[model samples]
Target: MPSSLSIAAFAAPLIQLAAAHGYVSGVTVNGGSWVDGSNPNWYYQPEGTAPDTPGWKALNQDNGFVSPDAYDTNDIACHKSATPGETYITASAGDTLTLYWNTWPDTHHGPVLNYLAECSGECTAATADGLSFTKISEAGLLSGSNPGTWATDTLIANNFTADVIIPGSLAAGNYVLRHEIIALHSAASANGAQSYPQCLNIQVGGSGSTALPAGEPATDFYSSADPGILFSLYTAFTSYTIPGPDVWTA
Candidate 1:
């Protein structure tokens, strides 16, 4: 029922968003130099296979995302067929880390969250599936209507960068840092949400004695029928509940 110009205008942004699928290009700890376990130079295309990085490599080389239809599958753990990184980055509790995304479309707005799962031993050799993840950080609807000032908006305002703070009370160990962004631009319909989750292997060192518990697996992270996952942003809304377990605190 829309005119040609109206349809074109509407499709323009969607096309842009599709062409600019995102990926974690690099990460910095305590405001240090940027480092990436995977390809740091991912643009229109990704470079040759990454040699080493604390960040796990997902199948989103084309900057693609995982839809809600795959919620119950192992693909939701990290991205899709995610492979563990060969090494990890060292950091201490209470350290702030910045995750850099290659690009993010403002049109795609939703929630941003982080989770941590400690490995039995060396995380470098750990697998993506079956890890118990505990929510550590979450930023949902910040303010305004049309889900205004969302975490994704703030991320865009900050040049496609998201900051995550390591829990100060977490025990020293090898862990997997899972950072995710849920794009709810088309969430009005079923299976419309787009999930962009990535992982990083971190060797944490601190005197804190609180070891992360064996939390719920990533498959139980969300359900297709969840209020947050099946939400709508096309209309006005005042509040938004982040979909997932409560964040683990000291």
Candidate 2:
């Protein structure tokens, strides 16, 4: 029951050449840029508020993507079930829950597309990012958690969608769901640093279906159905020195 799982090199590609004109730069993740008063590189903490139970509402500054300098788009947030402790796992009505974004990253700001190229070599881009989660109530939650202190829930918007609802009177076992992706860079005080945080570890079951429980490795490996076989296995392990070929001393 495995259809797809990818996030190794995400989408490795970040080529760039100026004077000669060669472009394809676009790959940056985790190492996008961050430092100096750092605090909002991206965040999400749900299990049960902290200090007491009345705080945790930043959702990346209410969807503005947090801009004291950066994060203009690319965010997602979700939490349902009364919103008190965020709970909902009891399936038995047309069960078919599916939310998948198996860790994606190959470009966000380092493959050099318009940020003055510098990733170098065949263009080894780095960030392509992705994540999603949905399910809201209690005024659509939005992002709140300051009761105990340890609040940080954000969702920018280059892309994000998460919705989970399974309360048909569940009574199974094993059920957990958590997804995260926080890569911030409010301009990093004019491109100094701060942008490196990509996470995804989700598991939702009760007969619904949502598993990313550590299994994402295959970001488009130059597919052609194994035709060249990595250039014929690098020309059969090249070590050419066949003058007259000692053909096994035959």
Candidate 3:
């Protein structure tokens, strides 16, 4: 009887979800100056409604506030004010945070709008750092299978919220929230100027581990342009050296 034989197959693609997780916090813009065509002083307006009064009045209400002066000559001056408890979610390693903001026609401009979560250290209040902003999510901007970029001239309308995903491998610690609108144009002119709105602040917390899996080995075959199996009846063996892992110690 022939000897018992067995073979094992170990060639399969490794698939994974990457262990990246994320969350979202809602933000509310309120309590700013409203430019209605009435009361010259700043007044208050209801949520989600423009000031009904006339003559460019400043609305002190949290929801419907407008600025008195047009920051840019080409663009109309508007105000954006967010509340204290705007951000509500926290994040950790293998996780993300998606910030939801109320949309308006004039809110969507080309600027680096960011949402950052702190893991250990405190988040910076300065607009220079501590935020992660991306272009508005439009179609056909991104090449791969992901959300695209914001379309030029695409204003932030109602029910339109941008998704700010925190990196999956971020460390765990306390986090603060803020936003900035870099003025695209200095003043309103025929050249189409833009102005950025003030940033708001909020706080959150997170805790978790961020460990990654080990690497696997790769296989390859040897090949030569030889016809005869027996040449000098000699076989030579060769070996290769792979670099070792460079570990970092905290």
Candidate 4:
């Protein structure tokens, strides 16, 4: 058995290591803000909740943790498992929403993407397998001397936040919003890319006449074998194709 003194000495370091992993701990919609791990409306099923939920299963996952890297896999879409409550942030078209994460390390450099999927009806009970999504916003590597790296990107870099515009003409409805980051620091090796995807419930109100494009299963986006996901980002890349469908800017 270990001595109490020894155990005490090791406890602090262990706690720090665990806390180092990051997660989206809070979000701001328009002028309203809510913290994660505590907000019932945010859609994260606490790990301590009885009978674990099925959507965004990796809710509150440490930033250091990554899901199985196979494309079109279950964990790729929303890291889902639990059926989140239907509570959502209410916003009109042309509003701004911001997501805040825990400490984001500079070493995890990659692209940031946002997607939206309209719900069939009530979103609180919707299953992850039954949902479909459309690309809405994408931010790739910044252009300059050090290209293909997200380390210097303003929104990502050492910051813990990102902001996105709600399409001015978005139709009125309830939709699932997915925010993601692809960490490519280790993409040179097979199955090395780390993807962190989080989902939220939102009720969008707008007079916009545009309709969502045909929905595709999360697996339809990219294959694990795709070059963009498996390639090394150590060198300069002139242009990058975000690994997903075109954005529906309308």
Give me the runs in candidate 3 sitting further than 4 Å from their true place: 1-88, 106-109, 115-158, 181-250
State the RMSD for candidate 1.
Answer: 7.5
Which prediction has more favorable lDDT, 1 or 4? 1
Which candidate, 1 or 3, would have the higher TM-score against the true structure?
Answer: 1
* Predicted candidate 3 versus true structure: per-residue lDDT over 1-250, tens digit per residue: 1111110010010001111111111332221221111211122335535333211122222222222133222111112321122222333333333323223333223332443323233332222222232221112111211112222123233223343343444345434332323222221223233322222232322443542222111011001111110111122213111111221121
94-166 in candidate 1: lDDT tens per residue? 9998887766788898999999999988887788775889999899998887757899988877767899999
Q: What is the C-alpha lDDT of each candidate?
A: 0.80, 0.20, 0.25, 0.63
TM-score of 4: 0.78
Q: Candidate 4: deviation at residue 74, Å?
A: 1.9
Task: Quote the positional error of residue 65 for candidate 1 in Å.
Answer: 1.2
In the range 106-169, model 4's lDDT, one tens digit per residue, is 7777778888888899677777777799888888767642334552255544246688787888
Q: Estimate each model's TM-score.
A: 0.88, 0.19, 0.32, 0.78
List the candidates ranked by TM-score, beginning with the highest.
Answer: 1, 4, 3, 2
Point to the candidate with the largest TM-score: 1
lDDT score for residue 203 of model 4: 79
Q: Find the 10 residues in a row with the least total lDDT in model 4.
A: 35-44
What is the alpha-carbon lDDT for the whole of candidate 4? 0.63
TM-score of 3: 0.32
